[model samples]
Target: MKIFNRVAAAIAAVACLSVGGAIAQSQAPLVVGSTLSLTGPLSATAMTHKLVGEIYVDQLNARGGLLGRKVEWLVKDDQSKPDLARTLYEQLITSDKVDLLIGPYGTGTILSAMGVAQRYNKVIVNHTLGIPSLSKYEMAFPSWSLGSDPGNTVPNTVFDAVAASPKPPKTVAIVTSKFPSIHFMSLGAREVAKKRGLQEVLFLEWDFGNRDFGPIAARIKDAKPDMIWVGDIALEGNMLLDAMKKIDYVPPIHFHTYPAPGPMSKSPDGNLALSMSIFEEHAPFTNNKVATDFIQIYHERTTKANMPDIAVEVQAAASYAAWQILEAGVRGANSFDDKAIAAWIRKNRVNTIYGQVRFDGPGNFGDDMMKVKQVQNGKWQMVWPTQFAAPGAKLQVR
Candidate 1:
């Protein structure tokens, strides 16, 4: 009986040892919280971001994740509403207890979420929306703005486009949504136009969430400006196009804030002749190695061959780059504390699809590397910066 008791004790000890070893091999999963506009006006654009996040997390997990732990993403839909975005952000931080927070789809959404992040002292890596005012917010908290600042770059890009035009537009008509974010974009463009000796004809503003753009389109047609600039989100894109078609008003040159569906062949009219501030970090035209790899992996996972839209490509690359930055900081500090990670990210320069990304004192990647793209023969081509241009852009005369 004593021999049997000894044997049983030895077996139990061995079993416990094996269990402990298994636990040691498998690290705890890192939790990341994401707020997205999955089911509202911006659903299409938001879905692109969600897919990119999923692809990134999946690839990271396949490669043993960060710090030998798998990355588990917790995504919440904000319905493209700022109030809901704030609520979701609070839930993510307090209840989900996420390790990090990522900005949502639009500037307004990001602004709302930032309040929650600040209150909780969470580490936020923003990729989607950029407001010049973000510098002020970053100064107050641990946050990084990974996207281009529209207030600064949009005006510059607009001026550059006008100066390069064969016959610089003298009269310009601008239309924007009432949303503060969209209004700011339009304001930037207007300032640039005014600086370039362009006469402002009609500065029309309409409700963003409303469907009818007919009244605004009528006013734009009456202005009969040499150039028309559309500063609104994707939802507004469709409405504006439809309204323009009704009026039979086509300006000599049309500049869009976001990548126009018509330029990408998504819109049948194909009226999107010129685009400014269109994020193309992952487009094959750029010949970026990192971008190519990301696209290939994204397609492989989804089994879909379509190239990702501009926003999705940029957001995904930026978000993944943010993760790489965070990983470096965590490894450098040997801790996941928000302040440590923020300090590390601010000091280190990380590589991304958009090239070397390092925040300035205000937590902004202050590189003025905006590219100009135009639609010719139904294909969007990069035609600026001399290095990326394919036989310079030819202006289509009206």
Candidate 2:
């Protein structure tokens, strides 16, 4: 009986120490602050951004932390409101007094926080803001296949893919939103279609928040377009796909500029949708140790937490890549000073899971910013710009 009691006490002590260790890590003093839409329409995306940020923080902590101090991450909910995002940035800068700042998840939120960032002289590494308009600001650094590049390249990529097919598509139709970014993408697609000598069988621009895609999809099917392109984000893409399914209008080729999480992620009938975006599973790492290690770590951590999907999110890859950029700057400069880190980043080629990148003066990748990926046989493959494609990655149009 005494031996049994001793064993129980020893087990209790071990459990207590494990819990205490986690608490101590959570209480670390080096705070990194950012705003996110944690409780609104964009909450799912925000969760992914937060998960990747936490993963990087955990990895850094495991390495004995940055500059001899543990990192604490503070993310305040912006509720997907631009006004709230501005207010949150003000609070993060003045009240929270975060040692570093990273850009939030959307173009509007990042744009709203710019004034605060400028006033406080904070250097922000943009994780998700893709609007080309935002590229003018020197303080915000965009990471991902860039929101701007897709508007131009998505159409060209789709055309190139179809043109290469055994049965080339000669007619194209486009359904897009009037939202500036998406609209611009539609115009770019139109231009690419013209350049490729494909007849414009149908073209429609729906107002923002116009939810019914049935009418548009029906018209596109009636037109019998050889290829169809949808220039909206993920939610609209899913709606369009569902509408198309109801009408039994599956085009030989379909493309989306935003690469939303639905229809394009995985389909039971062998994923056929093509999208232009940065994906973790398909990113061009080229045997780089830093990127491969980051990918492996992300998978291991997310799997252990029972949230493996987060590791596959494009935002997750980009958010962690932002941390990698900042981490390199912090360690290279050996200081937490934002200005010094920014200066170091401007001059140095930071290695990240995304690839080696050196920011142009305006915080955009000077070259090779985005890729064309297709979901073939339930796996995402980089199928464009042959130089950056993964091994065994090939394009197949069904």
Candidate 3:
């Protein structure tokens, strides 16, 4: 990675702030920008991402800042719409002239931002997206496993665990939201179920915004699957669960890609749920000092801001990891230049709280760091990728 001394000359001279001061506009502050789903359907996940980026930037500033320049994160609400996200991103790159870019949540929003990023030749550090279509772009860096893992393996980890269980499920049902990433995950899970010799009793997909899942749940119940596999957002997952409970349809195992930790904990019978997540409060796979400090800081920040206590979810960690990677890349390249940072990321392996991180040429990280966990008696228990499982972490079949 070649280091360039271009940070000081990149932007106009701007004001800098003290530790507790406002992040006001500045000519020299390294501008990092994005459009977030702050007030729309994806707000549940995007809100956490917003806070994670804020905390990461604050921590960086406290540690002398990025390349000796303060960071100004320019985030706008996209209302969870692709068109709005695209417009905001174009504004960020052209009018706002952000020095660096971070992507918004979901495959749709991130895909909306990709064209703007490529048109401007800006490096977009993606956090919540794993769309297969985004692989062809050189400037996109996906922080999660969906991009790099073969056949979308991150979403298949739970199925792998089911296959390995002593009393493996004999029948499986797959249901998913109509979104691109969730659809892809469901497809992968279906293949894994077949390969494991589990009978595919039912396979169904629904529109993303459909609120009524009772009919779907009734269908699932009729199938009498030994296990139910779901791929969808947290909100939709909760909707489906409620529908399942409406008819008392509780399969032996209910595994999901969306880690609906909050709702799952509050459900009448939460323990039966299982999901793959990176945000478990004390997940062993990400128990390094950085991760520990992140948790502590996140708590302190939320408390200080008078916000509700929210557990660190995958969205927060993945969003924070993207910032960490950006910081590492910028410092390594010694330049705010997009091309330089992208090249550095390609040439060097960055260490993050997630693990020793190295991306494939297409900016996808290894899925080996992902963990499969199940809820038991209102607590999360690591149950897959046994090599990284925490003490006492094991699969329990009811």
Candidate 4:
């Protein structure tokens, strides 16, 4: 009887130990890390990404987190520098020991992070990587769903929309920032414009962070093309528009690549400004329950934070979709193993805020669902592809 009691006590002790181990494991926080241009040239746009991430993380925790464990996001500021981004990613892996990785804002920073992820064999989900040809990393996925060749696909999409307009511009002036992705897409736009038989009257380039837009704006005015493709990102586009306004000039049909959403919409000259978009806070785009809830929360949070643009546009949508992809990958893998998550993402399609995105395309890119948007009534509205346009919104050209 004494020996049997001792054996039963030992069995109970083992059971308690197993229960404690499981509890401790379930309580552990799953850390995900990334860098953003929290300061520097890309900060304005990157702030949108930051906000989206925070919203997603909050909502994630509310939903019991991933795999029944809490999630902690460790974000470092890369100051819009690609080199700094590379170093930060390394530190995130070795020192911070994050379980998952998300890429930064710009193409340069994303590419930089890509290298470190490759070295560590970590699955990286990125947004805003424009030049897909440069994205050869198999395990790396882009949330900027501009197809395999954004340089070609995005430009063609924009051109297709404009061509359908009542008075299509016969001449186009291309002014571009030498930022990696912007420059690549601008070059492709130039080729596409010429191939489509539109005359290129002016082709100008400025260094990535060039604040002096007066000269460039003056040159665009001189070219006097019927349309202008302004490949400026963040506040660069705003600065150019301000310069053009000083010269009392507004190109008849000016298109921006990645403008500061808020400033651009508020700028009086920004009305009728055209740009590309994946998702906007409008019908068709917001039909899904996930997107509907996201837009509502985004509105509430950004308004509270007093952000520049409270509207959900391409940039914000892309960032939100990236988190969705990561979450889907985690859930699909159902494991903390990085390789398994990557493999699951590669083999399956994940429904994102941007729609159903699959990574089977070239460079693991999804379909190019790029749409054109115009500033209307102090808000950005989808104007092209009739189906996705806001109620009664159509391409409005000057």
Candidate 5:
């Protein structure tokens, strides 16, 4: 009788240990992968993205992570090269066996790496990089592709601003890099300009890696446009401004696809304070509690003295939002199978820092929420949406 009782107690102890081990395995960390351009022409923007991603992962881990599993982000520098991005993505999917994939800053990189993502059947939660065709692909694959479509958001903002302008420019000059990302931006911007009754005087494309804009400057001077639209990355955008100053070709309105007002606003000539598009999804100047909280956290982590500029702020928020959506989908599906999570993300409306987030049937995050922000008195002020307008934005001419 005594031997039997001892045997029963040992069996109970073994069962409890087995259950605890299973629980620990279930709560193990999930690994995620990223390919970013950390050392090339787009390095500055990529660095900002990296900082934001790091901060977000840190914060998420601090909060006990998502779905009972801490996230481990494995980031690789692609140096802004599409081929390198593809290689890194291949390695992450095969060797690292990452559970999720996110980022490849520019459109060209994203498009190139996406082929590998398709082959591996991985879920891609893009942070930035706007390729219009991605929407079409998502419709066919259903469980393969996903991301925000900046192409629609940017053009809509530009056209709306022009349509409402008190004295809209009659002639416009569109300048963009030949990179795949800016190509779409230029296409969208030109379409918007034409629809708004603005004549496109000069449509110029330059290689992003090229440092000299002298010829472009001369061409802009010759075109004598009433407005200038820039479709380049932040660094190239800054160089263009410098060239504009040197040429003294000041158009009535200077619009940029993204908010690059940081370097431009701080320029000795202050050439960037003209007109720009602040995607409502990425606008940091809003009174939204999420925006405020993100800004505070970003400032605390980075070396920047002031709050992160609009681009950095947007990148961080968007990256964090993507992570949250990824988590939601993972939890809702109750499985890490890429196909299941992708389907879940497509069907469900995710509440994120940005706002109520839901992808269209094609897996494209639609554009009803983009805010158009303008610079006034050396500050970025929300000019559209009326609900979040800054004090000086109300008086400024569109």
Candidate 6:
């Protein structure tokens, strides 16, 4: 009789534990919070990040979510304002009590998000953070993979590609926005151009949100450099190209820092433009089933959303990879504890659409995996390196 009673007690305890675990799993969804420039100058690029985040969250929930709990993405708009981003991040962490954080788009905004995440000791996975030197937080991981010194390495890559061109530019025009990251990289490019012995005939900077590019375009035309590096973000590239077209100036070669992908391809003046790319919808990049499926879904959804560009390019890939990093950290740690998740990410490599990514370097950065892409026909195609180039596509210069 005594033995029977002890056995029964043991069974009851096991049952209670099982029920408790089930209840916890079935409770409210695990919330992931972030901000985007949803309705401001950055909106053109932010839309891609927004769509990618939506797709990732939906897919995560479909897969039973993180830690067997349904996931909810709570995204707020920062209106392309860094100050507002800082405030919103605070609200997301404190008021909403989000379980996890994904970084907002743009360098300044991501920096703001990082500050809040650090204060709360929460882990953050970010994509498209251009200025790595500013990423001093230990909990912040970067998925953009532009290396430790992108300002230096990225310009070297650009210069190397142009040097290999049939008609390398003897003179260069460097124009940039006063936006934080763009300005930083442009300054680096200026030094790089001088080091490479390319004469710098023109250098200009404009306020970030300035709508008028007519004066800048006129100045660029007067310089008449062989190649022009336009440090543009969002719709700035299109605006500058329009201004140049109005003045009957056609640049022999133009490189944009980060342009609105869809609008650029659609612009008459934007044909043959070059830019940095981490991934594009192509054979080598889509060779795996995961990337191929993502491309297809992005196509269907972006079309439904009426996005200007419905193709999976660098911005889309980087955003998707950010979610991948966050998910991998969560699953590897098997806990929502921010410290545990950050530790796991620092210790492990996450295979993403941009290839295997690790966050153990300075500023939680990894290898530089960026490629040079050109607008060919109506598509952005990788063309710099021999292997990653789109089918039968190589650098075209005249």
Report the lDDT tens digits of candidate 1 across residue range 189-229.
88877777889999988776778888887888889888888
Clashing pairs in model 2, backbone N/Cα/C closer than 3 A = 234-260
Best by TM-score: 4
- Candidate 2: list runs displaced more than 4 Å: 1-28, 145-154, 207-210, 279-286, 300-313, 361-364, 387-393
Tens-digit lDDT track of model 3 for 58-166: 9898997887788889999999899999999999988987889998888899989987898889888888775655566787777775436534566467767877877
**Greater-lDDT candidate between 2 and 5:** 2
Give the per-residue lDDT digits (tens) of candidate 6, residues 1-398. Answer: 99999999999999999999989767769999999999999999998999999999999998988888899999999999999999999999989999899999999999988998999899999878999989999999998999889989999999888888889899999999999999999999999999999999999999999999999999999998999999999999999999999999988989999999999977767889999999998979989998988998999999999977788999999999999999999999999999999999999999999799878889989898888999988899998876999999988774
**TM per candidate:** 0.85, 0.83, 0.88, 0.95, 0.84, 0.94
Q: For candidate 2, which ten residues in a row score worst on lDDT?
A: 261-270
> lDDT per prediction?
0.66, 0.73, 0.76, 0.92, 0.67, 0.92
lDDT of 4: 0.92
Better-scoring candidate (lDDT), 2 or 3:
3
Clashes of each: 0, 1, 4, 0, 2, 0
Superior by TM-score: candidate 1 or candidate 4? 4
lDDT of 4 by residue, 78-122 (tens): 999999999999999999999999989999999999999999999
Q: Give the TM-score of candidate 3.
A: 0.88
Better of 4 and 5 by TM-score: 4
CA RMSD of all predictions: 3.8, 8.8, 7.9, 2.3, 4.2, 3.8
TM-score of 4: 0.95
Worst 10 residues of 5 by lDDT: 138-147
